[model samples]
Target: MVERIDAPAVGAPDPELKNSPIFDESDWDELSLDLELESGVCYFNDRSYAIGEFVCSGDELLRCEERGVWIREGACHD
Candidate 1:
């Protein structure tokens, strides 16, 4: 079964999604943003990702599994 990713313990609700009626927008935006990770990794209630996964931070793509520390995958292109 699918699990909910919007639980309060995961962190604050993404404002962009919270503002939308259907909540279809992404957590990303035009400016810089941050994510909370536990012990150098993100722990979602249902699953997780490792070093190779692509993390979208604002307009850039960071490649790192560790929280607070990011390895640059470079800026996202249009």
Candidate 2:
């Protein structure tokens, strides 16, 4: 037999907590570090790349991921 524990449902706000704005406009401005990031693009060395795009850094080849991050795909060849 499994024991069950009572708990609040997911996404349900707590009654004891006060509801207020988590962040102001100024805070949002500070958090907006990169404009390209808002467009679902990756930035490398001052260049913006689309998702699934590949780039070469020296000899290493990198692929742009969905989260605006570059991942190593392989080595660049001539």
Candidate 3:
């Protein structure tokens, strides 16, 4: 049987990942605006902007699993 793993606890630090610079202030601002315009929701980086769309809900963000993309609340990581 396949076991299931829970997503990292909300607000928990990510393991198996190293820090890296992702986006500058300007990039974040622009991306935020674009997402808002397209989906009516804004995304912010609690850590770094390298990881985009950390928080999203409504029809704003879509999760892409192996099966396909589906709308859902919260963040999606690859």
Candidate 4:
């Protein structure tokens, strides 16, 4: 006999995907323009970068991930 696994209820957020970053929507006020997710590019500081690209802001190194999301890789070194 085969068994089936139950999935979480709809609209319920996955706990694994709930990690909070220091930078969030509240920080958008410092930006000149809003970020719009492009087809295959990530938008940061009003600039568009291709996927898997890296961006350096101040001392932070950010990487462009899928879905136009920018994930912090680590600190930027000179």
Q: Model 1, residue 53: displacement in angstroms? A: 0.7
Q: How high is the CA lDDT of each candidate model?
A: 0.36, 0.48, 0.30, 0.49
For residues 38-66, write the lDDT of model 1, one tens digit per residue: 34444232234354454444555544343
Which pairs clash (backbone N, Cα, C closer than 3 Å) in model 1? none
Weakest 10 consecutive residues of candidate 1 by summed lDDT: 18-27
> Can you write out model 2's per-residue Cα lDDT over 7-33, one digit (the tens) per residue?
212232235542211222244445445
Better of 2 and 4 by lDDT: 4
Which segments of model 2 are wrong by more than 4 Å? 1-39
- Of 1 and 2, the candidate ahead on lDDT is 2
* Candidate 3 local lDDT, residue 10: 32
Best by lDDT: 4
Query: 1-78, model 4: which lDDT tens digit per residue?
Result: 433222211222235542212243344345334454334776554455677776565566666665566565555553
Better of 2 and 3 by lDDT: 2
* Window of ten residues with lowest summed lDDT in model 3: 62-71
What are the runs in model 1 whose C-alpha is more than 4 Å off? 1-48, 65-68
Descending-lDDT candidate ranking: 4, 2, 1, 3
